[model samples]
Target: MRGRKTDGDDERLPVISIVGLGPMGVRIGHALQAVKTRYTLLGHDVDAARVRAALGAGAVDRGTWSLAEAAAEADLLFLCEPVDAVCATLAQVAPHVRPGTLITDTAPLKAPVLAAAAQWVSEGVAFIGGHPIVRWPTDGDARPDADARTPAVGDGGGSVAAPPAPDAGSAAAVARSPA
Candidate 1:
């Protein structure tokens, strides 16, 4: 986030931060990069290796080891850790986040995550518990229950396909969460 663009540099471009560089997080970084929208991408993770991978892949513009520091720098902060770690991570970053920062997550379960985030909701800050539901077509190998599914990391291929590039409207869907 050290070199992230400021208003003087580019007012229209946003400074985005991803808090966990694990699978979903890194993929998200990639997706954001693939989009036409202009934004600065920053990433962090407990496992430094993940952050390195994200940076090497050009997913994030910069990677930092500090959670709170990243939170404070973000205009849009994404919680990319596994569901189990979401609550603790939320606690750590909440106080440091700039007001009006829109925080979202890739955690599968929204109810509990939203409930945990509910305590932090305030005037300018908003939390949206979101996950990209990776749906497989119905077939013998189908797992229709989205909640029970885990992300398929590798399919013997070296990389996973990024999600379809999001339009500006889709990315602009951040609003006050019902939490």
Candidate 2:
């Protein structure tokens, strides 16, 4: 979140942290890399192998096994873990997350996760419930392959899409520019 101020706006790019390096997390990392986003991607996973694989594939700028380290400076934290693990992971990272940090999840179900995240919202964190729906028809396999060239979320090709942010007035719409 460190950057020069420009016209009353912070020009610094956000530091994005992905908590789980599973298939979904990996896909998200790849998309970010493909787009050449200005943000720095910080990837983490309890499984050491997944962290190594994500780092080797260049999906993240860096990888870490420590949840606290990853969440410490993240401007945006994506909880890409499974539904059951989302709340637990949030609790573990809450202590390290800075105030005003935006946290979202890729979990399919939002009710339970959002309910569990109420504490974070009360603590001055922005909690946005996000679910990126994959539009590409899978070949009966729910997971994406390692080298798949899937489109980034919110792209017009219908590859990925996220739900509306909690604060609609503050949410910025994402549009893909001509390549």
TM-scores vs. true structure, each candidate:
0.69, 0.76
- Candidate 1 residues lying further than 4 Å off, grouped into runs, are 1-3, 6-12, 135-179
Model 1, span 20-109: residue lDDT tens: 876567666765776636678989888888777778877788899998878888888888777768877888887888787887887766
Writing each residue's lDDT as its tens digit, candidate 2 over 1-179 gives 53223345668666889989877787788888888747788899998888888888777888888898888868888899887799888788878888878888888887778777875444567777677755443555444344534644544332222333455434543444444
Go through the candidates in order and give each one's C-alpha lDDT.
0.66, 0.72
Tell how far residue 164 is off in model 2, in angstroms: 11
- Each candidate's clash count: 0, 0
Q: Model 2's lDDT to the true fold?
A: 0.72
RMSD of every candidate to native, in Å, equals 10.0, 5.5
Candidate 2, superposed: residue stretches over 4 Å from native: 2-13, 136-145, 152-179
Which pairs clash in the backbone of model 1? none
Candidate 1, 114: how far from true, in Å? 0.9
